[model samples]
Target: MMKITVALLFGGKSTEHEVSLQSAKNIINAIDKEKYELTLIGIDKRGQWFLCDQEDFLINGDSPKDIMLKHKGLAVAFQMGKDSEQLICFAEKTFTKSIDVVFPILHGTYGEDGTVQGLLTLANIPFVGPSPLGSGIGMDKDVAKRLLRDAGIPVAKSLTYHQWEQPGINFEAVVEQLGLPVFVKPASLGSSVGISKVKQQDELFAAIKEAFAFDHKIIIEECIEGQEIECAILGNEIPIASAVGAIIPQQEFYSYAAKYIDDQGAAIQIPADIPKEIAALVQELAIKAFQVLCCEGMARVDFFLTKEHNVLINEINTIPGFTKISMYPKLWGISGISYTDLIDRLIQLALERNIKDKSIRKSY
Candidate 1:
């Protein structure tokens, strides 16, 4: 039997580029070599793609702040071939490799916010994670919360502001609406990049400024007092949710540094110490949000579980971290799926979704 050829795409122009490298490293280490032939492709900060050597793909791999993609390999471009999407490398000699599937380990902005998904869709290639529409909806917190709230899902009250509205943003008015200790975040970013916890009225201006720097739009939400709970969802039409997990962040919140940089910044509590009933509810809501957001393949549904057992939808990560300590794989690991098995499942899911999508008549 021929092994499946998997193109692992990592790094990007996003602020989470370093985090994506870490994720790609873990995925490459854990993926089953016997069942899959891996082609490593790293995207640089400028959005250029290069075919990478699996062993020597990264520079400064040990230091998170300085880690970068080693751009020595053949610069590549994705093109739609006669039968499938081809990765064309134009160097001393031109060659093409047909990719069976793409596992985009990229997080944030250009990679996660539907841009790459759209490209893959146009090429009619099978890639892991949500569809273009799903990725777009999942990346925008402001849009996601509105959809969830409309579907009768509980979410924290918030306000959305574009860069143009900066001059009119009244800190006192926002405080009056969302209350104190609001979270200011770039609307379409993840890994907690450009997110600030505004505790005082004076801090609101700086927080908004910081968030707007990363994105054209920002969201301000009332800080919900509760435990940070997360549930991982897998599959397409009828997805299943994994056992719930909790993030015990040592910082004021799960900042970018706390997530990837600091080893002891956060403690991950698997099978969160919650009642079975609450866990079940969390799983139910997780699947609901996944479906509501049009997510397929996989997603990590974050929530705020209050002392009263109320679960408030926070946000959805279409391409959640796959790092050694990342919650997505860890939650599934505790739920009877090993890391390799989880990767296999995701690949299979992507293939299945592609077949289903192809079945739909395009000309009719």
Candidate 2:
């Protein structure tokens, strides 16, 4: 059998661009070299698509300018079209590499929000992770919460804000309604970017303002104090849930620093210290949450086990971080699936879905 040619898409135009590059590096490293041929594609912060071969992408410093400089001259332009239009130019030379499949290591915004998925759909290429609709909903915290709530799944009570809304409108009322120590997050970001935990009225405004800088919409939810649990969902039909894992953040909450920077940021409690019944319920809810958004390929369903011992669906990550340190792959690893095997399964699912899609009637 011929090895599948996987185009690993990463470094997208989003707040999590650096994180995406890190994830891509991890995925590229973990993919079984014997079973797959990797082609690395990067989207710079300016949204320029590039075909580049690099190893271990990392932030040069905290400054975006320094990060951009390190990657400045490495990008090769790419443009797509029908048949003859599919041309890529690098250093005034044209080349073509037909992609059998795509493994997008994108985290937030343009990557996980369905923009890249939509483009791939138009290109008639199979790509891993959620479908466009699923990706869209998964990327929006507000919408995800509403859907889970409607599906009879418990989610934290949340209040949403649009970016264009005036800042002075009855924030006190919102706090009164939702209660204090609420989490304020950008509706579309991941890796805890633009997320703040506010405990007081003064801090609430600052959190909202900071969150709005990353995205127009914001979601403020009452903090759910419990074990931070996560389970991985895979497959199109009869999706299977991996062993549940609980995250123990080393800070007041799971902030961006704790998620990526610190060495001892979180401790993973595999098969989380919960009752067998609660585990089963969490697994079932994870699968249900994945399907609610019409997800395919893979997703990481997050939850909060309350002090009362109730399980609540927190959110779903369609393109959960592929970093070896990331919870998604780690959970699967403990569930008897190797990182390489997990990648292979997702690729298989993508190809299977693409073939099925081609069989669908377009003129109906």
Evaluated with TM-score, which candidate comes out highest? 1
Give the poorly placed runs of model 1, Cα more than 4 Å off.
none
Candidate 2 global CA lDDT score = 0.81
lDDT of 2 by residue, 180-296 (tens): 778888888888898888887788778888898898888888888888999999999779999999899888887666666664777778979989888999999999999887888
Q: Taking the tens digit of each residue's C-alpha lDDT, what string does model 1 give over 1-364?
A: 7999999999999999999999999999999999999999999999889989998988888776677788778899889533454888989989888899999999999989899999888777899999999999999999999999999999999999999999999988998999989999999999999999998978989988999999999999999998999999999999999999999999999878877888789999999999999999999999999999999999999999998888898999999998767999999999999999999999999999989988899895
Q: Candidate 1, residue 178: CA error in Å?
A: 1.0
TM-score per model over all chains: 0.98, 0.93
Q: Give the TM-score comparing model 1 with the true structure, all chains together.
A: 0.98
Number of clashes found in candidate 1: 0
Note the residue pairs that clash in candidate 1: none
- State the lDDT at 332 in candidate 1: 98
Give each model's whole-structure lDDT: 0.92, 0.81
- Model 1 scores a C-alpha lDDT of 0.92
